[model samples]
Target: MTLKVTDLCIARGGIPVLTGVNFTLAPGAALILRGPNGSGKTTLLRTLAGLQPPLGGRIEAPPESLVYAGHADGIKQVLSVAENLTFWARVFGRRDIDAALAAFELAPLADRAAGTLSAGQKRRLGLARLLVTGRPVWLLDEPTVSLDAHATALFAAAVRAHLAEGGSALIATHIDLGLAEAAALDVAPLRARAPAPDDFDGVFA
Candidate 1:
């Protein structure tokens, strides 16, 4: 199944953040969302991930078919790296954790407390979580936020492989992710007024 958005509009309060946003992504395709700060990059990604409601739009996604990996990573700081990945693996019913960790170069930090790992290390662990799940769709917001060149390359390779396997990705990032044959969507022009307090209804509307 493909992910599609039609006539999507997002407002923070009463201010408009996104207007008439529309796009469709098929399996094995990747879309790189390029936008400056406050341009609704995160907002659109969140909306597509089903974390937020669109002000006026329609979305189609299958149950448990999509995964979101944002800057926060959705990680448990209290758990060790391995424990964190294990939790996700169990949640997603994945059979292999070591392979995922190794793929992300997180084997060494597997037992380290997530709170103790450096930013880049934590990000890598987050990617590992995504890999273990083997989900078909990925909604990544700044996935490479804290990664170095090497780690970034690793992430790129993994994403490429995911696409090769017929998985789709919609990534919001300010930098290049090195995805081959990926299309770029610019969201900067969609920015407008901030949503108003009363406009909160639009978020769920």
Candidate 2:
């Protein structure tokens, strides 16, 4: 599957944060979204994930064909790592959670509550949940935020494998993710343009 964004403009609280953004992600490819704070990296990712609606552009993709892993881990504080995966698996109508947990080296911590896990560990768990979905497109916002070298390597490997399998990804991160063919898109220029007085209301509303 492919992700196509046409003249996408994203807004927050009725103010334009990203404007006139355009890009396409073909299958087996990746895009690295970069920009300073308030430059709309996260906003762009959110828009692509369908978590945030576009103000005046269009995002064309199947509803259930994409997975979004945002800055928040999206974990349940009261649930164990395995429990969290179990819940999500059921939500997505899946049965097997072991393989995904194993892939992320989270099997040993399966029984531990997410609240007890370290930051990096929690991030890994969040990522593992995304893997379980087996979705064709991934919108990851700072996916490697708290991961260490080893975990980062694992995440990169997982991404490589995902692309090898003909999946597409749009990653918003400041760090290089070791994606060999991933194209980088800088959003600063778009954000630099002055916002119209009604830009926010027009775009985000």
Candidate 3:
């Protein structure tokens, strides 16, 4: 599936943060989003993922084709690693999790309680869920937060594999995944202007 965003505007806390945004993520391609800390990268990703509505403009893609991974690992601390993957797979209507475990090298930790794992291990586990989601588009925010160089390479490999199979990714990260299919976009220039004196963003339609 291809995702197209045209003249997109996104906001945070009811205040416009990014405007005039545009991009297309073709099948088998990845787009790396770059901007300063306060930039609207997260907002943009959230908007694209349909977690929040865009303030204006368009985002076109097949329905239910996107999955998002944010800064938090989004794991179940009480569950075993394998159980967690199984849980997500079932939720997404998938039944097998073997590929997810092997992709992130989480098989060794499969029976371990997620809470007992180190930060990097938790991160790997969190990313492993992507494999089971079965969605064609991935929206990742700071995906490599707790990973070491080796683990980062593992993630890059997984992404390459996903792309090789026609998946698309929109990643918001500082680390270079070294993907040849990567394209970079800087969103600083699109930061929104101060709200107008008469602007009624929260109160009006």
Candidate 4:
């Protein structure tokens, strides 16, 4: 599937943050969104995921085919690793959990309670949920947070495998994920500019 955004505008708390943004992501490709803090990368991803409406323009993609993973891991503290994946698999109407568990090397920790895992372990489990989601387009925000070098490489490999299987991803992160041929989008240029002092004078009228 192709995900296309044209002249997109995004806002946070009703305040415009980004405007005139545009991009197209084809199957087997990825787009990395780079920007400084508070630059609206997360807001853009959230809009694409349909968590919030775009302020303007259009996004052409099937809503049901997209899965979003935010900075939060979204794992149940009381659930076992395998059980957590099983629950998501059921939600997505997929019956298999082995692939996802093995993909993130979580098979060994399958029976471990989510609460007992370290920060990195929990992040891995959070990422593993993507596989079980059965959705093609992944919208991830800072997916590498708290991950060490080795774990980051593992996550990169999993993403590469997904793209090889014709899946696409839109990632918002500050560091390199080692995804070959992935396009980089610097959101700085797309950020909304505050109105000039003279322009704002009209608001007070």
Candidate 5:
């Protein structure tokens, strides 16, 4: 199914941050979000992932079609690497996690506790959860944070494989994940204008 967003508007803390956003993500494709820091990329992804309600506009997709991977890693530190994937897989009604483990080269550390992994390893484990989700649309926020070059390539390959299998991804990141087939969307132009300075703006200060 294609993921569609029409005239979308997003907000942070009840204040508009991105407006007039529009895009379509067809199956087997990836859309990379481009923007400088504080340009509402994270907020937009959060809204799209249903972490928060949209301020306006429409998102057209099947229910439970989207899966999100954010900066928090979302893994239980006490669980082993394999266990973490298994736990998420079960939540998504999946039981097979071998492919996910190998996708991130996490098999060797499968038995190690998530808390024992390094920063890069943890990030990879966090990302691997996407596979277990079995969701068609992926909303990723800064997916490569703390990843080294090899790990990034692993992630890029995993994304390519996902696209090949008719899955779509919306990623917010500044780095190239080596996905030449992925299209880019710059959110800077869609950024909501700064609110006009008001005399009472600093009243609370």
Candidate 6:
């Protein structure tokens, strides 16, 4: 699967955040989005994931082939770690949880309630869902937020394996994920300039 973006523009709170972004990602490749806070890295990822509409431009990728993991872990606190994975697998019409469990090293904590797990453990459970989804394109936002170095290594390994199997990822993060071959895009240049005070006053007045 391939994802192509052309002249994309994104907005937050009805104000433009980024404009004129373009990229094409092919299978077995990854793209890392880099930018300071409020630079629209998350906005771009959200737009690409179909979580929000783009102000302008085009994104060409099959809806079914994309899976997005945002800043939130998206785990049900009441459910056990294994149960959460099972639920997602069923939602995606799959029946395997072994790979997801082993991928994030959650096998030992499989039976533990998500609410009882530490922040890092919950994050792992959340990431484990990606493998179970069986999607070809991954849109991840700060996926390693609470993970330690060892867990980060595990995350990198999972991503590497996915790319090796012809899957692609677009990650928005601040730290290195060890995906050296991945293309990088710095969103700083794409940030939209705020309207001048006079322009805003004229419009409001």
- Identify the runs in model 1 with alpha carbons over 4 angstroms from their true place: 192-205
Q: For residues 48-126, could you state the per-residue lDDT of candidate 3 as single tens digits?
A: 8888998899999976899999988889999999999999999999989999999899998999999999999999999
Question: Deviation in angstroms for 15 in model 2?
Answer: 1.0
Candidate 2 ranges beyond 4 A from true positions: 196-205
TM-score of 1: 0.89
What C-alpha lDDT, on a 0 to 100 scale, does residue 9 get in candidate 5?
86
* Backbone Cα, N, C clashes tallied per candidate: 6, 2, 0, 0, 0, 0
Best by the TM-score measure: 6
Model 2, 40-156: lDDT tens digits are: 888788777777677778888897889999888999999999999999988888879987787789999999999999999999999998777879899998899999999999899
lDDT string for model 4 (142-182, tens) is 99998999889888998999999999999999898878789
Query: Which consecutive 10 residues in model 6 have the weakest lDDT in total?
Result: 196-205
TM per model? Answer: 0.89, 0.92, 0.95, 0.94, 0.95, 0.96
Per-candidate Cα lDDT values, in order, are 0.84, 0.87, 0.92, 0.92, 0.92, 0.93
TM-score of 5: 0.95
Worst 10 residues of 5 by lDDT: 196-205
Reference-based TM-score, model 3: 0.95
Question: Using alpha carbons, what is the TM-score of model 4?
Answer: 0.94
Residue 81's C-alpha lDDT in candidate 4? 98
Q: Candidate 2, overall lDDT?
A: 0.87
For candidate 6, the lDDT comes to 0.93
Tens-digit lDDT track for model 6 on 41-133? 988989898988988899999999999999899999999999999999999999899999999999999999999999999999999999999
In candidate 6 the C-alpha lDDT for residue 123 amounts to 93
Arranged by lDDT with the best first, the candidates are 6, 5, 3, 4, 2, 1
Model 3 gets an lDDT of 0.92
